[model samples]
Target: MIKTPSLREHIPKTFADIPETTAYEAGYLVTKNAGWRNVRPVIDKDKCIGCLQCYLYCPEGVIAKDGGKVKIDYDFCKGCGICKKMCKPDAIRMEAEKH
Candidate 1:
């Protein structure tokens, strides 16, 4: 059976402990195929219960909690539909990214 880290093991205890990523935001970053995604996830605020299932499952760590709402950072998101699949309330939807 596959094993996953527990919530306590996954989340950082403090902001200082958060892992840093320079590849996502660094010089010449705009040239890193920033807008190449054909699809992206959008969260429906009305339906979102802030369950954070999406945030927990996001491999890129681009999803964050803001004002008790779940926010997706499209900049680092790879158009993966994991968030939508994990959302029990069906709050997240994958829509075509508009050029």
Candidate 2:
């Protein structure tokens, strides 16, 4: 059986627990940057083919496989549309952030 690590396991316990990263890096580490997002990606599960294209192209590495489907971790997602663009099935779409 394939074992997947729970998202909780990756949460940082404190400020010191956050991994050090360079500004040049494309993604954030366990930090909730949703406040900075102007748009967010919403996945249509029914249209998803589970091809992993979105997962592979997500620059923030926020896309994950969930039971043969794909999910985006909005906390770290920077609202980039790479996932939606890479989604061949048109499963992902970007919408304006409500807040």
What 10-residue stretch in candidate 2 is worst by lDDT? 19-28
Candidate 2: tens digits of C-alpha lDDT, residues 1-99: 999999999996753454332122434354566689999999999999877777767787777666777677777788979988898889888999988
- lDDT of model number 1: 0.74
- TM-scores vs. true structure, each candidate: 0.67, 0.69
TM-score of 1: 0.67
Worst 10 residues of 1 by lDDT: 19-28
Clashes of each: 0, 0
Q: What's model 2's overall lDDT? A: 0.75
- Clash pairs (backbone) in predicted model 1: none
Q: lDDT for each of the candidates?
A: 0.74, 0.75
Give candidate 1 regions above 4 Å deviation.
Answer: 1-33
lDDT of 1 by residue, 1-99 (tens): 899878889776754454443124433345434377888999999999876788778887777766667787676688879989899999988899779
